[model samples]
Target: MKEKTIDYVLRATWMAVSKMYNEEAGKAGSTMATGFALLSIDPEKGTPSTSLGPKMGMEATSLSRILRTMEDKGIIVRKRNPEDGRSVLINLTNFGLEMRNFSKGVVLRFDEAVKENVSEEDLRTFIEVAHTIMELINNKKIYKPETSAK
Candidate 1:
């Protein structure tokens, strides 16, 4: 039997995880994006609008849409930053905080389940491999073959 490529395994795993999170979020009257945004924002100080997109690995347009939906749902509020006149801050409402806690619990439960099923050594290796893959992409090592022959 042919073995699956690493990328394929990674993508498939991510898709399955995302679908699970989305389903859970849907049951809570939210989306995965909303739950992620809620988790990303600082509960006390709020998060800067510009910083959230990069922090979430999301584009501004997509984050904007999510924020709008959150605001409409009374989950978040946008306030002008006192320290930076040109920037806006995203703050969670009381309901948003509740949802954030729920999101956190969901994440923790999933993590605990994985830990219970997977050995610690295997989990550590998986984390190391994931970090190495991320580092390769971040360092532009994956697509630098054109420069290799020079």
Candidate 2:
């Protein structure tokens, strides 16, 4: 058996989620995108999918479709950007905010449960290493060393 690592362990953990949330909230891909967008958005700018797509490693068309679905589900709303008429600002609906909070609570409880069994220092180190791995994977495309050149 392979030892649990970030990729395998995290995937397996999420794959084990059998709980059913509302269709609007249960979409893992959309939920994750919304979570990250909430983090990256400024209360002032309100966030736009155009800015969110690259950050979330999603395509423009895919993001658009996701946003549309979310809107139809009443999970989110879009408004024209005041500063740029051509752009739209994404805002969470009341239900959307509640869903975000609920998802966050689930994650927090899971973390606390893990902490109950692990040393604080070990948890800190594990998180730091995980963050480093995530940073590398997220920015892999930005590496520009011409290593194959003769």
Candidate 3:
């Protein structure tokens, strides 16, 4: 099989999984994850949208809108940075933490589903390929040719 074919298969599989998982997740899934990601980083220090957007590959404007929604829902709190008054810091509220925990359970159930559906060998291969893809895309690294031992 060609490398491009492998990429296509990987993308298709990802789409399928994501679609199913998102359906299961409903409105709570994506928003919950965003809130959880913010909480997971620095509870006390909090996270700035400026930093979080680029890291998540989300646009600042879009992130702001999401933040607004989360804020209205009481999922997160926005505080002014005392030192840097211009900066906005985001933190998860107790309600947000509970939602994040619920999302965790949903993700765990999805993991079990994936494990049951995909064989061990496939799962191993998928993990290696997924990590390679992440390293290539997120880490901006290239894949080097592996040398075989004689």
**Best candidate, lDDT-wise?**
1
Tens digit of lDDT per residue, candidate 1, span 1-150?
A: 299999889999999999999999988999888999999999999999999999999999999999999999999999999999999999999999999999998899899999999999999999999999999999988897565555
Off by over 4 Å in 3: 1-4, 27-45, 117-121, 135-150
User: How much does each candidate deviate from the true structure in C-alpha RMSD?
Assistant: 2.2, 4.7, 7.0
**lDDT value, residue 39 of candidate 2:** 46
- Model 1 off-target regions past 4 Å? 145-150
Off by over 4 Å in 2: 1-45, 135-150
Predictions in order: lDDT? 0.95, 0.67, 0.71
Candidate 3: residue 64 lDDT (0-100): 76
Clashing pairs in 2: none
Model 1 / residue 26 / CA error / Å: 0.9
Tens digits of per-residue lDDT, candidate 2, 1-150, equal 667766787777566552322233355444655554444444444677578787777788877877777788777788898888998888877767765676666566667778999999999998898788778867785475567857
Backbone clash total, candidate 2: 0
Q: Rank all candidate structures by their TM-score, best first, as comma-separated numbers.
A: 1, 3, 2
Candidate 2, residue 8: Cα displacement in angstroms equals 4.3
